[model samples]
Every structure is written in C-alpha cells, then in structure tokens.
Target: MGLARRIAGAVFLLLLLALGLAAWGRFRAPSAAERDALELLRVDSTPLPAKNAWHALWLLDYIIPAGEREAAYAQDLAQLRDRAVAVRAGTPVPPFRKWAENHYAALPKLTDDDRAAICRPVSQCLAQVRTHPEATRLALTRHADRLAAIAGLAGMDYLWNDMPPVTAAPGPDIGDVQALWLTAAASDFVEGRQQEGLAQACTSALTMRRLHVGGNDALGSMITARWAIEAGGLAMDMLAQMPDDAPVPAICAAAFAPPVDADVDFCEVSRAQWRGSFGSVENFPVVEHGAGGASWLLSRDQTRRLAAPAFVAACKADVRAAELADAHLDDAIQPRPTPDFIDRIGNVQGVDLAVAGVPNFVPYLRRNRDYAATLRMFGTALWLRTLKGDYRTLAARVAARPASVNPPGSRPIKAGPDGISLVMDLYAPVDGERVTTVPLPVPAS
Candidate 1:
C-alpha cells in the first residue's frame, strides 16, 4: 500500500510538470506569432502594399540583366505570398487585406515612391491568381475589388489636384488629365473591362477639349490638339483590339467635335489646318497644286508625292497657318524686321503684317519636321503610307521605329521653308533608347 501511494504521487507530480510546460509553451507561441503579425501590420500600414508585388515580379523578371542584388528581397516576397494566402484563408490573421485597401486608397496622397510601392502587392495578388487558378478565385476577386478601389482613389486625387486649374489662362492641365484617364482606362482594360475603359477614355478626351477651348494661348491650343490626337489613338487601339490597325475617325468624331461654346468657324478652320498640315484624315483627298498654279485633288498614291511643291504650297496657303504666323511672327523673329518692310508686306497682303499673334503654323511645321526625321530613321514611311494613309498610320510608324535614332541628352532641330522649324528632344525609353520626336505626320490629304 505504501509503494502504491508513492508511485501514484510521483506520477501526479510528473503530470503537473508536463501540464505547466505545455501551458508555458502555449503562452509563448502566441506572443511570438503576435509579434510577427504586428511587424507585418507595420509594413502593411505604409504604402508598401502597392509596390510589393510589382517589385517582386520585376526583380524576378530582370534581376540578373538589371545587375542588382535581389535574392533576399525575392525570398521575402515568397514568404509574403505564403502569409497573404494565410490571410486570405481567414486564419485570424491581421487585417492585411483591409490594410492594403486603405493603403491603396491613400496612394495618390502619398509620394510617387509610395504609390509605386503600393502597386507591388496588387501585382503579386494578380500573379497568385494566375498560378492558383480557380482555387484562389474568390481571394483574387476580393483583391481585384481592392485594386479597383485604389485605382479609383488615385484617379480622384488626380482629378482634384493634377487636373488643370479652371483659370482664365490656358495650360497643359487638360492634357495631364487625359493622360491620367488613359492610364486608368488601360488598367481597366488589362483587367478585362474593355467597355469601361473605352467610356472613360472617351469622356476624358471630351473633357480635355472643353478645357482647351477656354484658354486663349496659342501654345495651349497646340497642346490640346496634341492631346486630342493621343486620345484618338488610344480609342483606336482599344476599339480595334489589335496592335497594328488605326482607329477610324468615326470612333472619335463625337468626342473630337467642338463644344457649343467653341467658335464654330475657328474650330472648322482648325480642323482644316490639321488636315492640310498633317494627315489628320484617313481617306480625305490630298490637295495637289498643278503646274498651271491650279489645284487638283489626288487620292492615295503612295508615290512619295507628299513632299511635292504643290503640297507644300497648299500647306503654306492654309488660312490657320497664315493667322498663326501673323500672330506669332513678331515674337519669333528677334530684332524685329524694319517697320517699312512690315508696312510694305502689309500693303501687298492688305493686312497688318506688323500685327502679330501666336503663329499656328509654327506648331504644325515643328511637328512635320520631326515626323520627317523619324520617317527617315525608321524606313517605315513607305509601309505606313501603304497600310493606312492617315495620321494613325504615321504615328504607328513612329512607334515601331528603332530606338537608336534619338539618344538621351541630344536635341535635333529640323528647319522647313520660310524660317519654320521643329525641335525633337528625348523623353523616356521605349525599348532601350528614348524616342524623341514631335507627334506629327506627313499630310495625306
């Protein structure tokens, strides 16, 4: 009986010790897990959510070619992916999804670097969808909503701040808005929302035009025209859903037309100027000057007749060009020509030559000259002229050109007839080198 009692007591003591150790471990394990969760929450609180996935994918895509040290970063990204899965599975994890959404919504308020960072996680979520397929569809759906919300928030921020101020003066703010809209529309399109993208792009284009007309500056007008062209290009690209084809004018006609408050005559004249100076029309007849000084219209010939003297003469005769020149000549020509010369020219032309506004021809010529150089460099003019004889065709030709033509930090100026000139400067890299050219095309009609 004594032995039995001693054995039982020993067994009881061992059981108690075992229970205590188990309790201690249970308490310590949660503290460690909580610490990790808190650290993750700190990272999630910042705008890093946006950049996490993108950075990871980019690193994975080109780390070796990029010559960067990214192995550890890649591993961290892998770990994050696992944690994100846990969060998605409703494992009582921290509010990573909500945190991401909030961070994304606040993206535009953050700095550019912050915005970039926020994009990363969204990209990773997308990548997850691709690999896991249907198993992760629900999680991806939620992530998509978060991404869309973030995009909407960023867009609103742009509309509020980056949009052109409603001032009496003209500026590039309208163009900036249109650009932002295009970016948003592209995001939507990539997410398989084509119709939504098209609608947004169209609306943005119209808004840009409306804002453009309110301004009085010639530069402002030119800038707005360029925006219209770009918006039209985007519409065509999206509508066609092809890489090579140009968008028909009808697609953008509703958006391109002048608003009710716009000057009808001025707008018509501007459109005509666009047609004459650049191949703004896809199928319009080209106006050619005959040897007898009579003008005749020519159809698409593809004979390199775009540079004919008659075509040049027609461009010179353009009323808008003349008006722009008259407006801006004084400012453009330094040490202004003698008053007598201006008066004599004025008398011959029955207009005040000395009177100047901004020259409309300046922008047109500048764009054309740059177009010519790009055509020469790419050897794509013939193909472009043959495919679709329009401004879109010309733009595509420019887009498809090799990037070697214009390197960084180099500016090229090409001069045309009558002191007209165009300047080309490099922007961001397209493939490997910067593509710098004025967005203009050889007049097709």
Candidate 2:
C-alpha cells in the first residue's frame, strides 16, 4: 500500500512538471535563429494601403479603392458577397458578366478564333487589339482612369497587411495587364507622340512589375518578374513598330537597364510571406500569428520551424543566383532544396501549406535571376537599336555595352535572311532556354 501511494504521488509530480515545461516552452523568447529571421523579415511601415496598386487593380476586385474615398472596403465586400450569393442562387446574370462572356468568356480570353488571332501572341496583338470591331481594347480601357492612376503609383510601395488565404485571390492573368500597357504605348507611338509613348511603355512595365514585386507570397514575386520580362518582349515589338528615325529617350533605356531585384528585396519578401501567409494558415485553430516558431511546442510554430533553414538560406542563395543572372543556363548554380524535418522532439504537428512559402523560395530566386538576364538582353537590344545608325551597326554597338550584353558569344540580333529581329535566350525553370525574338518594324536606316 505504501509503494502504491508513492507511485501515485510520483506520477502526479511528473505531470505537474510536464505541464509547467510545456507552458514555458510555448511562451519562451525567440531563439537566435528566430531573431535573425525576424530581423531579415522586418518591413517599412509608412505606405498607405489605400494607395497600393494591389487594391487599385480592378481585376483584383477594385478592393479598398472602390467606394467613396472615405467609405470602408467592408461595404464593397458586403455588396459583392450579396451579389455573388444572388448569382449563385440563380438570379439573372449581372450585365458585366454578360458583357465579359461576350468578349472574354473564359480566362485567356477565348472569345473566338477571331479574337485569338488578333491577340493570342501579345507580341503580335499590341498593335491590332485596338482594331477589333467589338472594341476589344475596351476590355482593358474600360478601366482607363483607374489603370492610369495605378500606373502613376507604381514607384510607391504596396503594403498588404495580414490576410487569410481563404479570402485571398492569387490575382488575375497579369500578362493581360502588361498587354494593356503595351497596346496603349503602341497607340501613342502611332500618333507621333514618341516621348509620351515610350514613357507610357516604361510606366506600364513598371506598374505591372510593381503589381507583384513585394506584394504577394513567393508566387507574387515570380508573377511580377515573369510578366515584367514579358513586357520587354512586347515593348521590343512595339519599338519595332516605331519609325527608324524615332528617338529613344534616355529615360526609356534607363528604366529597364537595372537588375530585377533593384527596387524590391527578395529577402524582405520572405519576411512578408511569414507575416501574411502564415496568417492565412493561422485562421485554422491550430496556428498562432506570431513571426517565428517556438521550438518544441506542439503547435504551428514548431511545425513551421521546419521552414526556417530554407528561409534563412534564401537571403544568401539569392545573392549567389543573381550573380549568374547573365551566365549560361548550364552555368547557373542550383541551390539545394532544404528539407523540412522534426528533430528529436516532434510527434505529430501536421505540416501547413502556408509553411511551404519560404521553404519553396528557390524557384522564385531562379526566376528573378532569369528575368534580370532577359531584361539585360532586352535593354542591350534596345540600346543597340537606338545606336544602330546604319546597316551592320548592331554588332559594334552591342560590343560597346559589355556589362549589359550578357553571354556575348551569341549575337542577340538575329538579322535573318528575310528580316532583323532582336533576340534573347529567355530562360524558364521548366523549359530551359529558348531564343525569344522581337521583330523590329523599322527600316534599317
């Protein structure tokens, strides 16, 4: 009986001790690794969310910028929710939907073969989209004042506070957004407004670039870089449409000459991923909203801690990957994928998809470098076109900008037997590298 009593008391004491340790672990200060991650993730606090291009984009639902300037975005959501509910319940289709169905039924704008022929390859479509009898360009121009306003704010910061993943939309086909700007630019050039035309072209690219630059999770940065480099393709096509004697402004060349990571820092983007993306998962009862994982806690923190090594490693990896932005694809260094693991303590904290945001940053880093290289080629080609005073001048001028003309062995200007086109060895993580050509519409003066 005495032995049984002692065993009972001992078990009770151990239980008490375990509970104390659990509670302490849950609330303990962040560790050295945690602090370093937090420091890297910290962001500037000034930009007003109202001015964010993210909110201003109508395709993203014209969010906070919808109602009267002072009206709450909640009002817009309430109206939209009620409308969506009504539609789902079999109410008559909204006029906008009818109109959209007429011109752009499914995404990729598969209105018909005619529309596709006119706008499928954005490089080919920028000049002709305006000519569609149904006022095809209106698909973009309908949001004219708003588009212009958003473009004007491109250089400003976009601050997206914590938002749940369930409510968040990954955003529309932003490639269409770039096409919109390039079309407007082509229109300006045709009207003999060269200065204003190129300025609009640069601004539109900048706007699309800013749309995703520091805003969304890892996917957001990739979208921005992907589309921005795409803008270079369309812009080159638009430039081809310009008359040979057309002057290339210094601003137009300067705007595109820098690296992709110039204005937005990829490391800071990971910080934001933690703040907002984790909030997406935190909506689940199992997660906490703080910036870092508390080691050994049987909660989301410890589960997400598995992502820490990858997130921290990204800062260094980005620098290394970017160094090879201009090198050949075979020469680009691949950062090893960091695996998520549970050291001796973990039992069964399930992995959250949101936790993968930082762990999966390697692809985004590679895309950034590729975009930088592609942009360099685009800028270098633009520079040569501006300098090409007469026939066979491209080679000499391309050689002059050694720093900008990467992988110089291969001539970017493909003056084929029939015509001349500016080309870049565009790199994609999946398809490897392919020569992307933008045919110049100008006569070789």
Candidate 3:
C-alpha cells in the first residue's frame, strides 16, 4: 500500500481502539456500594431503614464548627455509649432495636479487613460499655479523632475553599442549585466523618448572599434579607455554644453585626395631602344655596372643612409607620406614633364630620349628599379609620399610669390603625424626663 493509505489505516485502527475502550469503561463502571464507599468513605447499608441517629448527628455537625466538632462528638459518643450500656442491660431498645439489628446484620458483609477496621474500635467500645462504662467514653473520642484524620487525608477541608462564589441574575439557576447540593453533600460528608459542618453551612450562606445580594438583577431585597437573617441566626447558634468567657475573635464577632440600612424613615408629602383632603371631605354633605332665604348659619359642613387638613395629616402618619416597619431591621424597636401627634389639625372625631365651611343652604345639602360617595372613592376613610384605631390602642397602653408599663428599653409596641397614635415620640427619652422634642414637619391641611 502507498504511504498515505498506510497512514489512513493506522488512524482507523486508533479510532476503533478508542471506541472499544469507551464501551468497556461504560460497562465496567463501579457498583453502587463501591461508588458510595469511594465517595462517602462508608457503605450505606439497609437503604430501607433510615439512619436517624446518624442524621441527627449530621445535623448537629452542620450547625457546629469544625473546631468544636470533636468535643461535640465526644459528648455525643459518651451519651450513646451510656445508652448502649443501658440497652445491653435489659434496657429495651424498642425504638432503636431495629436500627441496631440492621447495622449489626450488615456488619458481616464488610470485607474481613473492613470488618476488623470498624470492629476493632466497636469491640473496644463494647468492652468499655460492659466494664468501665465511664472510661469507655474515650472510645468515642478516639473514633472521632480517627475520622478527623481520615477527612484530613481526603482533603475534605478544601471543600468550601475550592467552591467558586455564586453569581447569577435575579432568577434561579440550575448551577446555583447544584452548588447548594454540593454544599449539602460536603455537609453530609463532614457529619459522617464527625467533623464540623458549620464551615460548610457558612460557605453555602456566603454563596447564597453573593447570588442573592451582590449580583445585579438578583433576588428581591426581602429574599436577601431572609437569607441574611437565617445566616445570622446560624452564626448566633454556633456562638451560643461557646462559653461567654471564651475570647471570640474579632472577625467572628463581626459576623453577628446587623446589616447596614437596618433602620430607615421616608416621608411622602403629595400622597399625604391627597389622603388628608379626601378624608376631611369624605363624610361631609354638600349643600346648595337655593332661592329660599339669605341666612348665614354655621352648619356641620363647616366642621368637616376645617378637619380636612387633619385627615391628610393622619394619612401621612400611617404611611410613615408602614415605611418604617418594612425598612426596619429585625433588631430595631420602633415606638408607635401617638394619636395626639398623628395630625396637628384633625382629631379622630373630625374624620366623620360634615363639610363645615359653607353657609347652611340648599347647596350645603347637595354637597353633603355626595360626601359618602366621594369618601368611598377616595379610599381614605377605611385606611384612616384603621390608623385611628391603631393609634388609640397604642396611646392607651403607653399613656397608662406608669411610664414603665411595658418595661424600659423594650421593643416598641405595635399598633393597628385604630391605636396608631400611641407610637409618636418627638423627643428622645432623657434621664427620667422628656427632653427638648424636635417637631416633625406637618403636611399642609
């Protein structure tokens, strides 16, 4: 054959070999047990029976940090040893008997070397249970140490370090879900190895924050806030496990710091004005001046006209409270605004008054006829009434005999609209006295 044909034959032979190798690999993939042992470092026997104790221990590991893992494991192991002793001493392991049986039954299936490896420690553990139950507790400690060593050998500590930061558009992504799954897998591994799972959780949280908070077009602020709260809660739980006297590193302490923009106040004048104007005129009756008699009389309409500004002021106050609640951080305590200060001009009583400015005539009656219809259209009557109710309840509670009714420096009382007025405090509380108060700008009536 010519040189070109010989080269073509050689290429064809190589391609054929590659295809054969690929087929062989597809057929020779590791079995489930082999794959699991390779991946998790232990065989998951008895798939039908859930590993309850193992799962609980895993959850504990996830919440706790690596530095505290061995200690926590030792404590848990001691308790388990005690329980096991009680079990062997005719203490019916009714709830756990099935689990114990399954675990023991699966043990014989392990290779002789694997059996010896696991059995040596377990036998030692059993002996301790039989004799010096208290001293046998150390077996748990030794087992934890061994597992930790194995994890270290497997480079498990790199799990979190190797993960890339998550960044995606506001919507969900399969990649993000996969990253979370991997984090969970790492968490499970750490738990199985009796290592700390907090690091895994923390890494996952940071990834979530990056995906949900730092990225543009990311999740809503509310979603980000929820995750932040959950992450902070987890950190707090871990911190709680440490002794109060234990010296906490500055970085760790800083993790618990509240997020910026925790407290916010916003004022909108236009909406407040509209609401107030609508409220004042809402329940009033329009009167028409007929060709009857020219007589100037103060009618109910005059009272309502005067109260329009007050109604607007109350609307402004309600808006402010809603804004405050939405923007305030979980740790913030906001006092309910007092009803007296809700509106400078109108009291709750004026909201239902008739239009008062015009002289009493036929025109007044005509205008009054449309009052209910206008009020219903404005949408302020119900909202303002609710605000009034909230203020009243808050006022009653706060204005009670003692200033210390709810306790000093406690969370601010939340008021529904009916009792909303109780929340206002123009002046900061001083040493047993109301100091000089700053006047909040009132909207035009």
Task: Give the winner by TM-score.
Answer: 2
Tell me the tens digit of each residue's lDDT in model 2 across 1-445: 9999999999999988766665554444555765565455454432455565443342332322334422433343444555545643447644322112233222233234423423455556555654652455454445565345445546546534322332322333343455555555655655567667667766656655565555645655665666666666666666676776677666557557655444334665666555554423433224333465432334455434444444554465446444344433332232322323332123133244323344455556556656666666666666666554555544445456665455444335444344556555545553454666656655743
Predicted candidate 3 versus true structure: per-residue lDDT over 262-306, tens digit per residue? 111111221222222322233233333446522122232223334
Q: Model 1 over residues 1-445: C-alpha lDDT tens digits?
A: 9999999999999988766654432233223433332233223112212222223222221213222323444443454555545643445543322222222222222234323322132213223334444433333233443334323322211111111112122212121233334555555554677667656555555544543433223344445444544554454445435233433333245554322223111332232332332222332233336784333222221111111211222123343343322222222411221223322322222112212211234334343333223323222222332355344433344455443333332234332222211223422222243443222233434
lDDT of 2 at 271: 60
Worst 10 residues of 2 by lDDT: 98-107
List runs of model 1 lying over 4 Å from the truth.
1-110, 114-176, 242-251, 256-318, 321-337, 341-361, 364-445
lDDT of each: 0.34, 0.51, 0.29
Residue 300 lDDT in candidate 2: 55
